[model samples]
Target: MYRIQEDHLDINQLTQALTESSSECGAIVTFVGRVRGSSEKNRSVKEIYLESYLSMTNKAMMEITEEVQLRWSAVEKISIVHRIGVIGLCEPIVFVGVSSKHRKDSFEAASFIMDQLKISVPLWKKENIEEQGWVWVSAKPSDKQAALRWRL
Candidate 1:
């Protein structure tokens, strides 16, 4: 499942999503993303404005989850969440969780989900700064490269 909210994410909800799965599981791997004070562009950070195309973002996340399942036999479940609207520095931006029978599968799936989401997810953000002003931060090329490694 997926959602966009201005409020803080619920770790309980993320855990619950990964726990509810079709394939029986033993281990669960999870990741939480947070906003940073600095930008890749090396500018002073203030707040971030997040946005996305609803249907496309949801579709992309679901597709990535399915791909994780198809590639890893040990995987049992996956959950992802991304926040939208204004977010301050150091605030959690998103979360990805994966469940599996073994650590390897859960670990790989969790990492893969985050990497894939970076590029595929339709969400966008703007970096706010004191002097530099607000600049839109799109998905990075490195993120695209990371996602390409998992493409079908």
Candidate 2:
């Protein structure tokens, strides 16, 4: 399952939902991404504003989830929830969870989902700096490389 919402993420609830449905799986890998307090350039960040076209974002997330299943057949379940709008520093922004019979598949699938989302999703981020003001965040080369590594 995947969702794009503006409300704050509840990590515990999301984890429970993902694990409860996959009791047969032995491994559950989860990742929670939070808003950083500082920018890549080491500047103080007050908050982050995220925006997305809901329909397009949902479609992209579904495609990514499907690809994960195709690549890792052992995966029993997957969950991805991303929050948009203004988020305070250190607030949870995204969650990715994967359950499988083994640790390897669960970990790899979770990582792949997050890497793909970073590059393929249509979400935009604007950082609110403490002193400099708001600045549109650009994609990083490292993120692109990470996603490319998963390609066949």
Candidate 3:
């Protein structure tokens, strides 16, 4: 399951829901992304704004889920919730949860989903730097390199 919302993300709720169905699920892994007070390139930030291409983002997320399932056949469930709109510093931005029969599959799948999301999702972010004001956030070279690790 995947959701793109403008409200705050309830990470615990999403994770609980992901593992609710399967009794065979022995491991559950979750990744939560949050807005930071500062980045290497930006400091004195107050808040951030996120804008997403809704339909396109959802499609991309679904594709990522499908790919994860293919790569980790033991992965039983996947839940991804990404928040948009104005997000305060330290607020949750995204959540990715995976349930599987073993820890290894769940861990790897959760990491893969998050890495793919950073690059593949159509989300545009603007940082509200205190002195710099709102500046558009671009894709980082590090993010691309991280995503490249999953190429199949």
Candidate 4:
């Protein structure tokens, strides 16, 4: 399952749903990405505004989910939820969850999904900085590196 919305994420609900009917899986790994109070450059952040091409974003997320399932055949269930619109600092922005019979597959799959989502998903972020005001956030080199490592 995958979704792109402006609503705040419900961490508890999402996690429960991931384990529902997933009794066979021994591990359930989940990740929640939150809006940070400070930016990479040490700027104070008041909020972040996320924009996305809805249909394209959903399609890309679905494709990433399918790829994860193929790469980790032991993965039984996957869920991705990304929020758009304006989000306050420390609020949850994205959620990724994966269930598998082994902890290794579940952890790796969850990490891969987040990395792919950062690079492949069509979502843009603008940060409201204390001094600089609103500025568009760019992809960090470290993020690209993280995703590249999975290719090997």
List TM-score per model, in order.
0.88, 0.97, 0.96, 0.97
Expressed as tens digits, the lDDT of each residue in 1-152 for candidate 1 is 55666788888877987777765688988888888888897788998999888889878877887788788988876778788988888888888887889989899888888888787778877889869788987677898888777665
Query: Which candidate's lDDT is highest?
Result: 2
Which residue pairs collide, candidate 4?
Answer: none
Candidate 1 clashes between residue pairs 3 or more apart in a chain or in different chains: none
* Residue 30 Cα positional deviation in candidate 4, in Å, after optimal superposition: 0.6
| Ranking 1 against 3 by TM-score, winner | 3
Between 3 and 4, whose lDDT is larger? 4
Clashing pairs in 3: none
lDDT of candidate model 3 versus the reference: 0.90
What's the lDDT for residue 90 in model 4?
95
Q: Model 2: per-residue lDDT, tens digit, 1-152?
A: 99999998989998887777555688999999998999998989999999999999999999999999999988998999999999999999999999898899999999999999999999999999997999999999999999999986
Of candidate 2, the 10-residue stretch with the lowest lDDT total is: 15-24
- Candidate 3, residues 26-100, lDDT tens digits: the string is 999988889899966748778999999899999999999999989999999999999999999899999989999
